[model samples]
Target: MKQTALKRWFNSGGPGVWLSAGAVSIAVIMTIGLLAVIAVRGLGHFWPSDVIAAQYDVPGQESHVLVGELVQSEQVPRARLKGAGLPVPDQGPEFMTRDLFKIGNRDISPGDFSWVIGEWLKDQRKPAQLMTLERREWGNFYGYLVNVKEDGNVIAQGEAAWPQLQARIERVQGISDQLDRLEKGEIGAINHGIERLRLRARKLELDGKLDAAAQADMASERAEFDARYKAVESQLAALHADFNRDSLTARDGNGKEIEIGIGKVVHAYQPNAMGTMTKLGFYFQKLWEFLSDDPREANTEGGIFPAIFGTVMMTLIMAVIVTPFGVLAAVYLREYARQGVMTRLIRIAVNNLAGVPAIVYGVFGLGFFVYVLGGSLDRLFFPEALPAPTFGTPGLLWASLTLALLAVPVVIVATEEGLARIPLTLREGSLALGATKAETLWKIVLPMASPAMMTGLILAVARAAGEVAPLMLVGVVKMAPSLPLDGNYPYLHLDQKIMHLGFHIYDVGFQSPNVEAARPLVYATALLLVLVIALLNLSAVTIRNRLRDKYKAFED
Candidate 1:
């Protein structure tokens, strides 16, 4: 009876159902685990970690104080330590524990990090006065604050200097904001205007229209631009003078004093003194900076706003380009075209195109879209910018178009399937009610299929947003501090190169000179990229759900 029952269950496909469920459950668990690991590694980076001030007592070597955050620790083979010429005892256990410390002061040391055997670290303590100075250059400074100076005169020293330094930093920050506005905003616009005038003059000269009157007009424009630039330059000089007025002296672990200009420091914090609430606030602040500020330290520090902006802008442009064309092709295939061998072949080709390698599309876009199409457009339209090649370059437009082409086949297949699902009786009824074939499609067929179109779009966006390979060949760069869209006359500059989150991850993870420092950033960027894709997909899914609800009556 038991054997018969087991055979009956197998015949009912119960085992296959259970196996499929188990597979799905395992996938979900693995995905969650991966995300959790990424979050812990990346998000923990912003949390202010207690700086360890410890004595390093190596056998037969003088002891020295080591100061910095305890970055990580691991047990390694003693043989590995011996290979590195470290004084590991030959009689000790085969595996020895090692700690990696971020002893920032890269200007003083060859590197900002050091590896020390765990056993050699003596008198490990977290001093409340230990300071961590986040700097714009040379990574970070781990030391003790000595004094605050103004105009080479000591303004505040001892315990009084910390508060004074904090106040001065706040004041400098306000001044810095003003300076940034003048530099990147007003001065940037002035420079852009000057370039445009120069380009205009060049265009006239190329067209054989640079007569005396034209020259005079161009010269007048150039003079006005120069006058504006000079005025801004004066303002910038004043700001710079104020920016460098204050400096702070700090003492390192060896009690050596070094003076750093206040302008160079981004932030100063004593992690050991910070309460949990204080650390939480500081963490959120750093997280905000990571999202909003421009990257520094070879793309290992600061925010990834440019990358986030580029990824969203490119995905949006790709969606706009792919949608109508994809829908049209699907309409033609499922509604208008004759059901013949040629039509079948066309469908087959499109389905196969969907499976083509993404990098292949990148190559095609570079060769056809950029070199051929863009070059032709540049020559025909921007003749004066010939040698420079305005559109005949790898940029945002080419990247978007490449992604659009790569994604269009998915849209076509999805939309065609949606159309095929629509009952023929609805189309016949629409026609019987005096609607033409085009009208029937436009009002009846397309409306009901809008949900499926959105389904395809969600998939396309999910794929395109995370794509790094094709973007690298087309437009994405390691650093594009200046965004593509700015306050210029043509606000949206599609021809400019852009920074993308996906490419940022690959660059920081693989190509960075500071491997250990950039490691956490890789995880953080990967997590952000996943969130961005999810957000994009969620938006499309919301729209799809709305459309499905709105047209539910027709489907029933």
Candidate 2:
């Protein structure tokens, strides 16, 4: 009776349903697990880890002390360690443990990370005075405070040096901020004005319209800009002199002391001495810096604000470009075009376009959009900027257009499906009420189909946000000096190269010279990209759900 019941349950499709459910559950669990791993690896990088000072005595190597954060530890087969040219003890078990240390001071050391056999580490202790110096260049410095100086003379040393160093650093930072403003803001504007005057003169000369009056006016404008530039330059020089006056000397574990400019240090903290509250505050501070600051150290350190801005802006542009075109095309095919051979072939082609390799789209975009269309635009509208390429270069505009082309088919298919689901009686009813086909589509049909459009937009955003290959060919760059949208006139500069998170991840993960240093950044960037896509999709999904709710009665 039990066997018969079980067989009957299977025959009734219960087993199939349960099996499908189990498969979906497993898939969901795997995805969650992957994201969890990424989060742990990425978010943990910013935390203030306790610095460990270890005495090492390895055979065939110099006995010395090492100090830094103990980044990771893993057990490997004894044979593997031997194969890798490490001296593994044969008396031990078949496996041996190894620890990776982030021994910073990259300016002094051969590298920032080193792997040591766990057995060779004799005495490991967390030294309270060990300081971690986060710098703007050459990664980080792990050391102890020696002295604080001004004008090459030691003003404070030993314990007093720490507080003096902090005070001077704050003053130096203020000076640095002033220098940045003078250089990038006031000075930058003056330089831009001078360039405009020069261009104006060139244009007038080209048109044979340069008279004495025009020349005098241009000269006066140039003179004004030059005066402003000189004043800003003088201020900058003074700020730099002041900023460079304060310096600090630090001694590493090897007792070698190096003097670093106060301006070069981003932050210095004694991780081992820090209490839980201090570490928490430091962690959140680092996290905020990562999200808000511009990247330094060859895109390996600092914040990814530019990449984040570029990504969000590009996706928004692509959506704006794709939606109207996709909706119009779908409406024409479904409501206007007659059902025949040509229409059927067109439908097949649209479906196939969705499956086409994304790289192929990138190539087509490079050839047609960047080369042909953009070149023509530059020649016609920006003739003075010739040879510099201007619009004829890979930029945000072309990138957005390329992605729009790549994503339009998805939108079309989705909108068409929505239109098809709308019953025939509604259309007939609208027509009987003296509504034209265009009117019906614009008012009734499109409104009901809006939910599907939003669905397509969500899919497009998800796909486009993660895309790196096509963006490389179109507009994305390793580093953009200025963001596409900035305080400059015509603030939204379409013909500007952008830093994208997807491309940033690719560059850091694969192309970076320092692989170990870039690895954690890769995970962090990947997590941020995923979050960006999720937020974008969630927004679209919310709008879609609302539309679906409002339009459900019409469908019924």
Candidate 3:
């Protein structure tokens, strides 16, 4: 009875009539729930960028809690002292920074970047036995520093002897004092004069019953002087601050280990060298400074504008390139070409091309464009720009071209479908009125198919904007110091390196020297890329939908 009733209920019509619907619904619900959790946690990690000051053990002089003697590298040179046949030394172990690599299980791989610096952290009045991240701990970190090309080379096994921090600080302070004298003499006087002038001007401006022309002239002069004064004052203030060292700060926390924030922060450690990866080690404070600061160092430090600019520019170039070729191919196939085996073959080829791996396109682009064309052009036209390479190195133009190839199929398919959907009578009517084939195509078929063309373009833009692999093979730089297009003599230097957010993501996550510092930024850049792609799609979709609606009544 129960079985029959259950079967009947399962077989019932409407909502009751179901097979695998419950399973599907449950699966979907679970999928959505999981995604929601990941998004919430992942996204939250990228926000609230604050940089707090932290100090390590005063350089050189360190306390050892393990025993009365200072803990040195010889104390426990390797994590597994017995296995290495190197027992923890009886004398205070003098440690090396790279030695951290031998310490088992403390891999910063998933976390990304290295934040080890050899310094002192004053935790309370007592010199807390803080593990210095860089100098002292670097020896331990060397094992991990071993990369694909070099093993045991990047890291030194033994402790490196260097002048103590106390000595270095004294020398630095001596120079700093001399610099301070110059500031006090020249800078202080200049600032004082400007302040006096400002006060005088304010008083004069407020003086009543002056002639209109005199008033106008005075106001203009005062404004100009004020602007110049402010600019100089700002620079002076910055100079003053740079010379001053920050005092130690203390705070009471809820004993809560703060959740590390992930977001974009831009700084350049290396000024010269193309494709040099400047992975500035992460600091909690660095993150906050980046968010609130404007770009400097030729728009390098404290700003991610260059990376953001490259991403936008590359996407635009890709879209412009792909849209025309894609739509044209689509138009020819749908409107001009006759339906036959040849057309079918072409369509099949296009569909197949779309499925080809994006990375493969990168390889093809590098060979054909960078090596073949770039080399040929360099020889013929730009012989002067020879060894440096005008178009040889993988850069912006190649990246854009690579992306365009990837997007072409999308545009072609969308446009072809749109063209097919147009009413036959529209074309026939135009032809019947003695309009030429070209005229009919331009005035009738194209207008009707535009929505589809727009749709294709939008899709292409979204896909190309966040592409990384093809860009890797092409012209995306890890750190493009100067953008491709700048206010230089030529204005548009096509051969120059360009940055991309997608590449930025890879660099911050994998290539940064300061992985701990860059983690939050990696997440932020990913989120930004997603938002940007969505925005591109949204804008394109809005236009396409509007065009579709406008033509809907004609179709009806």
Task: List model 3 lDDT by residue over 421-518, tens digit each.
Answer: 98889888889999998999887888778898998898788777877888887888776655577443356666777877788778777876655445
Against the true structure, candidate 1 reaches a TM-score of 0.98
lDDT tens digits, residue span 44-85, model 2: 899999998888888787998899888889998889988887
| Candidate 2: pairs in clash | none
Model 2 clashes, total count: 0
Among all candidates shown, the one with the greatest lDDT: 1
lDDT against the true structure, per candidate, is 0.93, 0.90, 0.57
Go through the candidates in order and give the C-alpha RMSD of each one to the true structure.
Answer: 1.1, 1.7, 17.2
Candidate 1 global lDDT? 0.93
Query: Once superposed on the true structure, which residue ranges of model 2 sit more than 4 Å away at CA?
Result: 1-8, 83-90
TM-score, structure 2 vs. true: 0.96
**How many residue pairs clash in all the candidates, one count each?**
0, 0, 51
lDDT of 1 by residue, 1-556 (tens): 9999999999999999999999999999999999999999999999999999999999989999999899899999999998999887888888988999999998888998998998899899999999999998899999999999999999999999999999888888888999989988999898889888888988998889999999998889889988998998999899899999999999999898999999988899999999999999999999999999999998999899999999999999999999999999999999889999999999999999989999999999999999999999999988887789888999999999999999999999999999999999999999999999989999899999999999889888988888888888888899999988889978898899999999999999999999999999999999999999999999999999999999999989
